[model samples]
Target: MTHVVGESCIGCKYTDCVAVCPVECFHEGPNFLVIDPEVCIDCGVCVAECPVEAVYDEKMLPAEQGEYVELNARLAKQWPLIVQSTEPLPEADTWAEKQDKREHLMEMS
Candidate 1:
């Protein structure tokens, strides 16, 4: 199984997880990030690195956040690979604690 980046990452776009990823599984979007299932090592390193607690093991994902598994796979195919850490969006702090932000997700980078 792979780790998935959930809705909590919709606007935060924090890349702390990316920096610690051992594989090039992360994909960058306009204001989000996704992990390519095919490339992910399921290392679990990204999970603890996420400041927003957005990363989760596929099986451990909350029922409400289950869709993120597929969302991450689909978006990973469209977005570019992000192998390093980068500054988060300016409004990251404001959006970090917000819930159900999926509608705000940008499909394009």
Candidate 2:
């Protein structure tokens, strides 16, 4: 199964996961990142690089964060990836603070 990026990563735009992905499945969203399941090699590199521990295998995804499995697949179908960010980004504080916002920020990225 491919890796899925979850809620803990909702607003934390850390690019570490993007850098390590061999297939470039990590795509940036407005508030988080999405993984393209079709392209993911299932190598788990992105999961290891994620600072928030937000990346997980689709089969290993937590029950509460299950939506991310679909989210990752959908976005990967669209954006696919961002190839050039030169650094490990700090946590996106604004996104983290919006605990109640209901908009699908990942889709808008």
Candidate 3:
């Protein structure tokens, strides 16, 4: 299974996880990142790199965050691939611990 970037990443958009992904499966959007399930190696490397604990193994994803599995798959196809780590959003620190931020997600980079 692939790793899913969930709500915890919506506005925080930290790139720490991107730096550890061996398969280059991450896709960048305006304020978040998604893993291309098709390309992900399921390495679980990104999970520990994420400061916000946004990345999760598909099978272990919390029930409340299940929708992110599909969201990651769909957005990965639309957003550009992000192979290297970059600065997070300016408000990352402010949003890192915030919950229910899915409605704040932007579709474009």
Candidate 4:
């Protein structure tokens, strides 16, 4: 398993997490940031760097936020290849509170 980003990261789009990620697995989402499961090393660096506390490990994530495991994995597969960075900020603002009304997904996972 790996770490995941949730609701707290929505419109926040801060790049603090990206700066600490050694693998640079985080990517710029239309609104928020997403982790690349395919490359994430499960180091948990991004977790501590997150200002809003939006990052969580797979095992620590709450039951309600579990779906984020699949969401990040699936989306990462679809995202185009990007140059990994030590700290990259999100580009757009597709986030709005609960963009998809699945705000619970932000609680832990």
Q: How does each model score on TM-score?
A: 0.96, 0.79, 0.96, 0.71
* Cα lDDT of model 3 by residue, 1-109, tens digit: 7789988998888898999888899999999899999999988999999999999999989999898988899999999999888999898999997888988999876
Model 4 ranges off by over 4 Å: 80-109
lDDT of 1 by residue, 26-100 (tens): 999999999999999888999999999999999988999887888899999999999889999999999998988
Ranked candidates (TM-score, high to low): 1, 3, 2, 4
Name the better of 1 and 3 by lDDT: 1
Name the TM-score of candidate 3: 0.96
**lDDT tens string, model 2, 9-90?**
7666778877776667677766677888878889987778776787898899978778778877877777646765544335
Query: In model 3, how many backbone clashes occur?
Result: 0
Best by lDDT, which number?
Answer: 1
Pairs in clash, predicted candidate 2: 30-109
Q: Which scores better on TM-score, 2 or 3?
A: 3
Candidate 1 residues lying further than 4 Å off, grouped into runs, are none
Clashes of each: 0, 1, 0, 2
